[model samples]
Target: MQIKPLIGALGAELLDIDISAPLPPDTLAAVRRALFDYQVIVFRDQKLTLDQHKQFARQFGPLHVHPYILAKPLDGHPEVLRVVKEKDDRRVFGEKWHSDVTFLERPVLGSVLYAIETPSKGGDTLFANMYMAYETLSDGMKAMLEPLTAIHETPVPEVDPATGRPLEPMRLVNKRGEHPVLFTHPETGRKLLYLNTTYVTHFKGMTPEESRPLIDYLCEHATQAAFTCRVRWAPGTVTFWDNRSTQHLPINDYHGERREMHRVTIET
Candidate 1:
């Protein structure tokens, strides 16, 4: 297997490794190392069945089954989590920058997504390099944030369609969880900016008024266009991303077009 870096920021394209066929140990090691360095790795042009996909994902770590969630379980394969957007469904998964499944007490380490069906255009996934996001921070900002902890939650801001009246205010659960604004990657041992605009409500000690400017500035810095890499999908493509060092946004630009992918996440 050969891995080619896609861009200077954070992604790679792997060549000659077929997901359907069993991967040899050395080949898997090379792929794993590339993922650690690039934070996101893409495998192109190989169609992977549900079983084959899950098998490859298992080589990384134990699969994480989301707690407190229910889905139409995929037949015969409990490890493969399905993601589908029907013609009428406007919502797309991963629409915001996040560490996958971080609302859980223990966050997932990484994720593998294989595209089964893709739209002709505009259903891209964008990834940001959190390590670079942290490295670029001013020394002063870094020092100030090192001792701070921010809350993380999974609250959808949308209205409750079931009620005709306006939806009740949604509360961000799991509040007051202190995470360093800067987190160090476990495997690579590199520091990374760790806050998410969607999950982070406020800093630990500051009032909302005090934290607004600092939090807003960090968010904008982390998501700058220069720091992001966008991936356009094709059928039979597989993308594996380390959740510890990166965040992603799935574009909702492909309305009325069918897009489907199966996901398997590694335990943190």
Candidate 2:
């Protein structure tokens, strides 16, 4: 099976790899290497069962479960996360920029998402190349951020699904961390803009007011079109993205329609 890049600009064009079958040795190696280089890879038009999806995800590493999710657990399989958006109950996930499960000390390495049920139109996932975002930063901007650290916190009164109640702050542990302004990827040795608005409430020393402008600026810069890629969903499509070096936003374009996907996040 030969690997073809999907788009002229971004995304991988996978040719003739049966995701339903066991990945061949050479094909698996090629896919792994491509993920590190591209940060986002897509396997188009291969429908696999829930079990097959879980099996393929484990080939990379252990999965990272969402720490704050109060609803249905991943069935003791911490890796598998169910993203379902039904008509009466519509909870859109990851609409904001985020690196998955970054509240953990050792963040998620990557994620594999399978589109189970997709709307006819709309609902695409967007990924930004943090490596490119970092490389293009101005010298003065880099210098200003070198000493800073962002405080990532999962606040109490969580957003509840049923009745939309904000749950009381559970006693939080390992809920916050000081991530460097610039983080280097372990495998590729590439620097990336390491901030996520959802996880990062403020910088270590700066007040919310003081940190707002610069933090917002960097986040906007990191997700600029020049360093970004968008993937439209199809039922059999699977996307594996490097969580350590990429930020993602799931477009909630279809409100009334059902949009469900199965996701497994590899541990970092």
Which candidate has the highest lDDT of all? 2
lDDT of 2 by residue, 125-220 (tens): 888888878889999988888888888876554556433556676444548777888887888887778988888878999898899888899999
Tell me the spans in candidate 2 whose CA falls farther than 4 Å from its real position.
Answer: 6-10, 74-76, 89-91, 161-174
> In model 1, what is the error at residue 72, expressed in angstroms?
5.7
lDDT of 1 by residue, 1-268 (tens): 7878878899999988787876798887888899998899999997777777878888888998743232334777777777777656666655567777665556577999999899889889999998889999889988988988777666554543222234456442442345778887778888889888767777887786887788788888998878878777999889999997888988888877888888888885
Each model's C-alpha lDDT?
0.78, 0.79
So what's the TM-score on candidate 1?
0.88
**TM-scores of all predicted structures:** 0.88, 0.90
